[model samples]
Target: MKKRLLILPLLVITVLLAGCIGDGTKNMEQQTELKGVLKLDGSTTVYPIAKTAAEEFMKLHPAVTIDVQQSSTGEGLVKFLAGETDISDATRAPKDNEYAEAQRKGMKLHMTVISNDAVGIIVHTSNPVSDLTTAQLKAIYFDGTITDWSQLTNGTKKGKINIYNTDPKISGTAELFNTKIAGSADKPYVAGTTIIHPTPKMIPTIKDDPDGLAYTPVNWINNEVKMVKVNGVAPTQKTILDTSYLLSRKMYMITDGAPKGLNREFISYILSGDGQSIVQKEGFIPVT
Candidate 1:
């Protein structure tokens, strides 16, 4: 009877110990399994890098979900200030008013520079003009002084310039072009410039029209259009990195504040060597 009693106690202890061990193992698994949703929005110009990074990140952490949206930089800032997104991709830093609004909402904005790219002056592939001086660019885009292709010093063609402007209200590309190349926002595009949205849209329209001229992120440059040299400097990776390219700008990922938890992890991944490699692969100059 004493043996039976001792055996019963041992068996109870064994079962209880087994249950505890199993629970510990399960808890460990739960802790290691990254399971959550991460939201990212903004900057169609930065969308390629963001999308590539998000895809690679989700592969390593299949349980985690990442949602990336290609709203313009302005819209992304709006969403970030409104608390609609976890991160905002931007082609430029937030404006003063944007920072003021975030302060009013008691949110601290943190900006991370991820990559560098230039606003390329693109013309149809057949256009003979290969390089433009800054003065000529300002004249063409800002002062409406050069409206015909023949007006260029090297020009051999005689068509009226078909200018395409990115939507200044939303596109950072347009805003940067206006600020850097055109000299100021007040100078404005010559009256009749066609306004395009999403940057890439300018590609097809310009490709179809031989006389078209537009500015877009260098990554979007393809054989369909010829990227003109600005002030005798091409928007190559070397020039962009060296700051010799006149229109170079830093791309960013903005958070409400210093990121925490999964947000921190994801941003770390983006700044990692692998992430920077992806940025280069996508034709943008990696910040690292």
Candidate 2:
């Protein structure tokens, strides 16, 4: 009877191992057969997060290739509408003009929420200005009221404020900045301000300048720059998730309608719990 019990236990173990091997083999087959290069671009803000995800996805499915680029939100939309890419990552939804343009071109778009982004104004660490009200921000950047750091704070330096911002026409970061800080569409570049392109460029510029104020997606704010408090409220994950941060922006994956193949599968993963964890880890709010 003991020998018979031993044989039964051995059979159970063998069957369990076989099941495990079968599942792994199935996954391998799926990976090997998965094909197609997913071309994606847009929102320099979403670039790092999406690029990281693409790199991770490639590890599991080596047969598939993904290309992520930063061409700003408007350029991405144009590319998506032209069917030049399979995915367009953006910080905002399609504007009325963009939607009309897509319709005119006979393009259909489907949106997938990937994450939430806090549009934050970062200043050089050397600047003493810590907090700003919405009205003050508007006056400084648009109306040219507060021209120097000393006007806003009792800092040692009394130099003119240098503003660095994303491309006004192509970036959602610019759109938010225009709406919240400029309070109008006709904002002239403040004197001593520079408009940076590709959005990511602001990271290094802000780090190098001593009197610069720039706005970007919070995830892109490297340790080199210090985030400023708006109306005495700092930009935090809690504030962003709760919609307390007035400058926060929603991020999305703009596709040429419902996607298929690995593109669809990967997007599904992004909306999954595991994928969202990656977003949170990268300092952005997860859509899940």
Candidate 3:
């Protein structure tokens, strides 16, 4: 008698789709026959969140595939408009000319707000500064006018401020600061001879230098560094969600027009409870 080898078939399951955007598949844990590849690119900041969403989504719908890539937000929109990708991960909202360009191609863009990121203007715990206006922020980070803490007009922690900034080339928070406060990263901060480094040591630097000032993700701000307000609004979840925080920006996933099929399902998963949890895990403020 010959020995027989038995091979089990790979995947066999019923499809159970969830209700509404952000519901995901919690209602039904079974696998789906859903198949096809989804391509997404842009915004390194949003890359992690999007990638995680793709990974978890594919787990449930094993037949489906999702590809996520990272680039500048502007570049991502360009690719999205060119039909190179199914979705674009963006750290900022769709720009006016981008919308126009999409219209020129006879396609209207649809935006889905996935998360919010805010750059907290941090200072030493000893610093008495409380808030900074947007214009004052430009003067400090862009124009480099207010070199000393005494010029802040908020309170008295008078000293020569040791300005520290993260390089925009590698720091998403820096890039965001450039666009939101500095107006242009290309012509940023000519006002002072400041120390420039990456984000890892920002808190330590500020901790050591009593008169230090810098910016980092709102979440990074803790007992070590005091997070000051922008335009009298503190960088908090409520302020970020309300757009009251000046340095706050929304992260988005865009489609050529309305998202459908895989595009729709993928984004919906991200907006769902499971997906929003991923957003929080990635250091982003969840929108829902």
> What's the lDDT for all of these models?
0.88, 0.82, 0.77
Candidate 2 Cα errors over 4 Å, as ranges: 1-33, 154-157
Query: What would the per-residue lDDT of candidate 1 be over residues 10-127, giving only the tens digit for each residue?
Result: 9999999999999999999989888799888999989999998999999999999999999899999999899889999999888888999999999999998888888999999999
Best-fitting candidate, scored by TM-score: 1
Arranged by lDDT with the best first, the candidates are: 1, 2, 3
- lDDT (tens digit, per residue) of candidate 3 on 3-107: 222222211111222233235564343345578999998776688899899999999888898988887577788888898999988766666677899989998
Index of the highest-lDDT prediction: 1
Q: What TM-score does candidate 3 get on C-alpha atoms?
A: 0.68
Better of 2 and 3 by TM-score: 2
Worst 10 residues of 1 by lDDT: 181-190
Give model 2's TM-score versus the native structure.
0.83
Question: Can you give the lDDT of residue 16 in candidate 1?
Answer: 100
Clash totals for all candidate models: 0, 0, 1
Q: What's the candidate order when arranged by decreasing TM-score? A: 1, 2, 3
lDDT (tens digit, per residue) of candidate 2 on 1-288: 999999999999999999999999999988668677899998878888888888888887787799999888888988888888889989877888888888888777778888888888888887777788898888887778788888877767787788776666788888887877777544766666787886767878889988888887777777888888898888887888887888977888987677777778889878888788888888888877
Worst 10 residues of 3 by lDDT: 7-16
Cα deviation in Å at residue 23, candidate 1?
5.5
- Candidate 2, residue 174: the lDDT equals 88
Tell me how far the alpha carbon of residue 204 in candidate 3 is from the true structure, in angstroms, after superposition. 7.9
Return the TM-score for each candidate structure: 0.90, 0.83, 0.68
